[model samples]
Target chain A: MDPVGLSGYLTVGAVLFVCGVICMATKRNAVGVLMGVELVLNGANINFVAFSRHTALGLDGQIASLFVIVLAAAEAAVALAIVLNFYNNHLTIDVDRAVELKG
Target chain B: MSVPELLNHVLHTDLPRSVQIFAPELVLCVTIIALLLVRMLKWHHKFPTSWVALFGTLAAFVGVFAQFMYMKTGGELPQMRELFEFWGLTQAGVGTAGEYFTGLLVHDPFAVFFRLGLVLFLVLVQALTILTGIPDQEDGQDFYTLMIGATIGMMLACGANNLLMLFMAVEMMSVPSYAMVGFLKGRRLSSEAALKYVVYGAGIAGVMVYGVSLLAGVLGTLSIPELGSRFELLMGDQPFSLTNPTAVATALGIMLVVVGLAFKLSLVPFHFWCPDAFEGASAEVGGFLSVASKAAAFALLVRFALAFQGSGEAIQTLCLIFGISLGVVSCLSMTLGNLAAYTQTNLKRLLAYSTIAHAGYMVMAISALMVLLSGSADPVDSAACVEGLMYYIAVYLFMNLTAFAVVAFVRNETYREDIEAYNGLSAGGPMTKLLCFCLLIAFVSLVGLPPMGGFFGKFAIFASALKAGSVHWFLWVVLAIGGLNTVFSLFYYLKVLRAVFILPSADESRTVEIPGFNGAYVALITLPILALGMSWVMGDLTATAHDVAAYLFH
Candidate 1:
């Protein structure tokens, strides 16, 4: 009856979580990191729906998880849009190069 | 039933309350499709296309307003049910839906209030776009679609009953905005802004997702109301107690979830991309990004915070710590934003920092929200903070959009967009100068000054902090600093106002004619700035804020 079988979902979530961490730590594409965020959300989303099916707490788990996924997506889209415009202006996709306002 | 048959069954028959609760988003979906069809037509001039976009928003606004007026409340049922509603679902607790959309969503006052605020802002943004004519610059079909689509995503973010829905709504809103950020594709700074926005967005979103996984895997539920119910049931003696390892893990999940949501709100540590993106993007996009998006994110925050509300020491301690620290960090953000604004000669970049300062104000309201919910606080005091934040955001939509309208107006003529360019506006254009003075008052309001709603907004939050008696010093210090910052902010506002009214036009011979529609639009926005002084109109805000407090506190 365990949809994620605990460890399987855990492993997927772990991989996604680590991948997102790695993406945030390493990627310079900006939009690529956004994709990584989407992946991380998908991983977590898998866990939520999985748990909803598996546990006594029932549908609430899946519902809250659904809200998280939607908000993350909205944030990502706007951020990516902003990044696209930023790159249009700055002529670079690299994050380290965007420190002009730091002073 | 077969797959298509079952799908039709859910579509054709009675809709659950959760779907009805999300009615505004449903209306927007219809508008988006209509906009998509408009993209095919070759317009002789772009004004009609823009009108289609504008009226589409107006229509959507009407729909949301009507839905809000007719919305059924949970805990108490409405006398009658509407034949049509969000996602085609019936009203919750009033009509049935197999535990409210199979427990992936709920129809509560909390989500409804947030959704109403979001729709109001969306209408404002659409109206601003119409008034300003930002579409005059390019082929703008995709622009309108993306704007509407992103807005729908924002509404969904407010009502997401399931984590999966949350992620989907977030992406639905994010993707279009990414494209929109880069919509002015030829501009160097616009592209740079888009890139920075995307990177920052991805990083925070990823962090939040990891947080989500932790919550779901440990606590085994993603449904918010159910999570609230189960977390309440947990321990049977003391609620939300982590002393039981399972509860502890759930508590940890809640922390991580806060991290994800905070990234959206642009709280410290996650606020890096805001200034850059704001600076790099155009004024209209920047304004939209700053206000509408943040309001939606706050909707998520309010819901999630209440979801974890319990009688446990650990959870309450977490709330208290976060609330207090967020207050200090908010002060820092405000200082940083104002100081940054002072040095900027470019009007767009200056407005960018102003957006940051406004964000700090919103966060300040949120921190107060946390304090009010902790049961240890007085109920009456909590009500002030709740109402204050709600009214602040509502007034903020009108005030901020007015400021952006001025920017758009000036930008349209001569295509120059720097503070220096505004130097001669007064002599050349009287109406523009008048509008600039009105916007100056708006700036004053944003600074939380009197005769403007911003003053009461600030007063309410400060009063709540005083009433709570827990963060007395923090509140007083913030007030002192906020008062000082208001003075500092006045200098820059006056600087812009002087350019518009006191200074001579760079060319003394030229006079600018005010277009009828644009003039009326600015005039329309002007009324509310002064309305802030009327206590009768302002009195309702405190009551509404109390309702917001009651939802979370109850």
Candidate 2:
């Protein structure tokens, strides 16, 4: 298999997407869901570089992906902080238990 | 030829300009590394580590300012400066001469402006961290390290010119933020918020990756400059044989990728996590997410939109659709955000809706940019919109901070964020009353009313839209709706205002005690809310925006 082609990236992306779905489905810990984010980003990244190689996305695809990474970090930070605060009032970070928010 | 060899060749041509363009952020990188090394040393709780981060941010601010001045000084030859950043870049990078990393990244007014924005936000967050002091439960050392680490990622995001850089920058920033969010792991809601963010984030990332793969498969290269060269060709051609399969699959992929980015911006349909996350989080955390994260995401949106603009390709057309979709989503978002805000009494949730509405405002700007992308190149392309977004976010930071500070103050006494909890707040608490008034200014600004920084920012954006959207009445009507949404927004923004001031005090006889210097920290954020609105200090910001627009749209 030639290492630098479309199928390669497509496969990587598919694997990542599936993995993230599974992670989102299975994760009970708040931080574990965040791990899914890391995996998900890695999946997109593979696609970005793949495109950088095979298509006219050129640098912009890569650039857009890069911005995505930065934002994910900012989002994670605030999200984690909020989660911590939530636990300060509650005792568990179980997704199922967050029902107190349902007013 | 191989990728590296080809990239090297491109780099050779870009070197001279690259050095100048990369200077501002490069300066921050050096300072950040130095701070990291400094933090590794153990001092008797007297190392003044927070001051170190503050100083670095300020220096980065000064460096970015200098870089902006340098570009404005040398690159003002309107026609030439407008042509390409490679020509106008003049920032003196540190340690060695700076150079472009091919056209993947470039130094120019726009990058300088975003870098400046990052510096300000970094300083803002650092100040909050410093004033709050170390949480009794956590180690202060690693916290600051992660904070600086995340700031570096943001700085890099502003400079990113290609896809690889974008991804790396996002992860670089996100990893640290995730840690920060879980800083209070003992608390369940905070942990839950972190979990929701991660799951949602990962899911969105998957969609984005699939989309990027499709884009790469179809386009052949991820370099935006190269993509621009082939924009018409890629978008204009049918890649998937003599069948409709090509457009269907590729467009779907592109939409998927947008979902990833859209998730970050909390664009309506993908915004399920926002209210809960805001409610579950700390005020500081909420404030940072509401402003900094949005600013960084807008930068990505501008870059992506610009990359695919025109071409009449399905993807380019997809971007146009996304723009309209984003606008439609934003209008609903603002209404939902503001109107829902009226029903809820929890300050954080109200602010959450408020944050959603602002995201809608930004997306609306992006939507307008799409129309501009679809229309002609006259009155310029989407640059005006980008510039408007930058200014809008600048206002958002200060206004949001003021709002959050007030909530933090109230939280200390009552530990409550409910609307009725604010009853008679002004009865005996003088500072709380003053803080409430400042928050009123912030709310007015958020709704885009006059004399505040928010109004000026919105006015500039709307005026630009009127020009770009003029050719298409439908586009104009959509933009008009965006304007109307802001008015409708006022009703909800004021509801919170009423809660803080007009409603009876939650504690009539007892007042919350001020926590030393922390009171001052809350007051300090108000300076920018008033300054940028009054002194036109953001003139440089506004001027620099012209270049940011040109960088992307041109």
Tens digits of per-residue lDDT for model 1 on A50-85?
666665536765665667666775676567556655
Candidate 2, residues B364-483, lDDT tens digits: the string is 677777777666556465677777887888888888888887787677667777877776665545666666677778888888777788988888777766765664455566567777
CA lDDT, candidate 2, residue B152? 72
Clashes of each: 77, 65
Tens-digit lDDT string for candidate 1 (B412-464): 77577778777767554567657666677777787777778877776776666
Q: Clashes in candidate 1: how many?
A: 77
Candidate DockQ scores, in order: 0.42, 0.36
Off by over 4 Å in 2: A1-94, B1-40, B75-99, B134-138, B228-231, B235-246, B311-319, B468-474, B513-523, B534-541, B551-554
In candidate 1, stretches whose alpha carbon ends up further than 4 angstroms from where it belongs are A1-16, A29-92, A97-103, B1-21, B41-47, B71-100, B108-110, B136-138, B232-252, B471-484, B503-514, B548-554
On the 0 to 100 scale, the lDDT of residue B14 in model 1 is: 32
Candidates in order, interface RMSD in Å: 3.9, 4.8
RMSD (Cα, Å) for all candidates, in order, is: 5.1, 5.9
Task: Supply the DockQ value of model 2.
Answer: 0.36
